[model samples]
Target: MNKTICALAAATLATGAAASEPIAVTAPGPQGDLAGTLIEPAEGKPVVLIVPGSGPTDRDGNNPMGVNASSYRLLAEALSQRGIGSLRIDKRGMFESRAAIPDPNDVTISAYAEDVSAWISVVRARTEVDCVFVLGHSEGGLVALEAGQKSDDLCGILLVASVGRPLGDTLREQLQSNPANAVVLDEAFAAIAKLEAGEGVDTQDMHRGLMPLFNPAVQGFLIDMFARIPAELAAGVEVPMLIVAGGKDIQTPVTDAEALAEGQPAAKLIVIDDMNHVLKPVEGDSRLANIATYSDASLPVHPELVDAIASFLEDSKS
Candidate 1:
């Protein structure tokens, strides 16, 4: 946690474009249908697909886990200002995407990749751009990487806070580093190991003592979750990429972004000095309030965060 990174994420926010008229669209999803808004540049410009992160997260980069800054919305607005079009959407069975699936947790990275394709189809039909770039945060970054591998129409990939190392490895490191609970540390490790092996540990079983680690829904994702590193996946991609990490991001450290960038032949890396996971500027190494700002809509995300992505996107076009 970088004490000086109080403005890391705040630098990436777009404060002006939220009031603009954003184009809205709803596309068919695996479980049901997803609702989305496409914010295009007034002058007509290339578009980006705003991929949502994990666990009931909305198109706005918000989640039921407490993030509500509408980070993705701010990002889209910022991109619009840069003359780049963007499409943000609700995940399957959440908010407007509620109809996309029968059960929200029944989704995995592959499903998300499918959703990206669906959104791309919609973007192509309406916009003149030949392909849309993918901007994925955290878990969403993995989805974007997967999609980029297959989507020939993909313009490029922009990964923010994406898991560069295998998720299982990151989980182990987090557990070892966190001072929270010593009791569940080994249990959590065992469960993660099982999930990594593509085995299911009953979240209900006590002797196994790995419930939260192996929830039925998330387990399926974990089967493939910790399997690949985002950098390795993006390494083979021909699309241009920009990888940004915050100096103080406790969830996914700046090193994670560096590792991903390393795997690629020519990807740019911009490490903000003091940005947190939520793009907020933190005053100290204490991550105590990091989760708190996720709900702070009035707070401005770090400008550098947005600049890094926008700069990379613009540079790629050049």
Candidate 2:
């Protein structure tokens, strides 16, 4: 794993009669060092690795690109409150993990899967647990599936608002679903096509508003990601699996979770009502409200989402 323990301890959080320390943790990455937070209830207790989604999302599940919802952070807190341990990590080259790599855009899905494996080993070593559960949200679920193929130590996998089909298909659906993206729909689809075909899309003519998403720097990585099918990976998983989707999620719909469960018929699927992509509760069927939750960091994630994850982890351990 090449993990170096420079652990800094923090006060323990009460979770029922038990409590766990929130410790700063790190592991070696291909380019540098990966950083994360580890909350351990006790040695040998089942732990979860909270893998963040796409873009510049950090270990806390908040990104500067208008996504400040602390999805991962809240999930970790909720799990800890139930006496479950968890590790939420920053991808190499972002936020506290910025120094882990020279450039984030130079990475691929396989690299991320490898990082997951490293994290699994590091977490097990540090917590003295035999295995760890992986809870991957959105794009991170794909990484979890790939990492599962590489390691037998994983206790199970939880896919939250993750895709079951190829990324190109989901990208198209998401772009077309939003009227505000209508102006850039054609350009976005064209770029996605090029990336899916393993080619680079020139961004010189791309709309300035879409540059952050389709910039040349990230094209190579996007091309690699677009090639991996999450369903195919899920189908090959031999470990316990759970797929959670939000009924009101605008980004990745409940159907995606259905497809994942279909791919792996043994997997348990749970669809939470009013839960959005950011894990926050959204009212009615308002897309505006759903999207607004992305920026509201203070909003608590749907309680059902946490309950589902904690229950799944407990069952996995048994």
TM-score top scorer = 2
Model 1 Cα lDDT, one tens digit per residue, 1-318? 112111111122354332235766877787567788887543435788988877778878787777898888887777776666789978777788877777777777778888889889888886667658898888888999998888587888888888898888888998788676577787788788887887887666444434555667667777877777777798877888888888888889887888898888588788888887767666677656676667887777788887787677667777
Query: What digit string (tens of lDDT, one per residue) describes model 2 on residues 1-318?
Result: 224444333334453525465778888887677999988854445789999999889988888789988888888877776667899999988887778788877888888888888888898787777769898899999988988785577889989999888899998997888789999998888889989999988888779978988888888888989998888888899999989999898888888898888889999999987898999988898778788998887998899988898788778777
By lDDT, the best candidate is 2
Q: Flag regions of model 1 displaced more than 4 Å.
A: 1-19, 207-210
The models' CA-based lDDT, in order, is 0.76, 0.84
- lDDT (C-alpha) at residue 119 in model 1: 89
TM-score of each: 0.88, 0.91
Q: State the lDDT at 298 in candidate 1.
A: 71
Model 2 worst lDDT run, 10 consecutive residues: 1-10
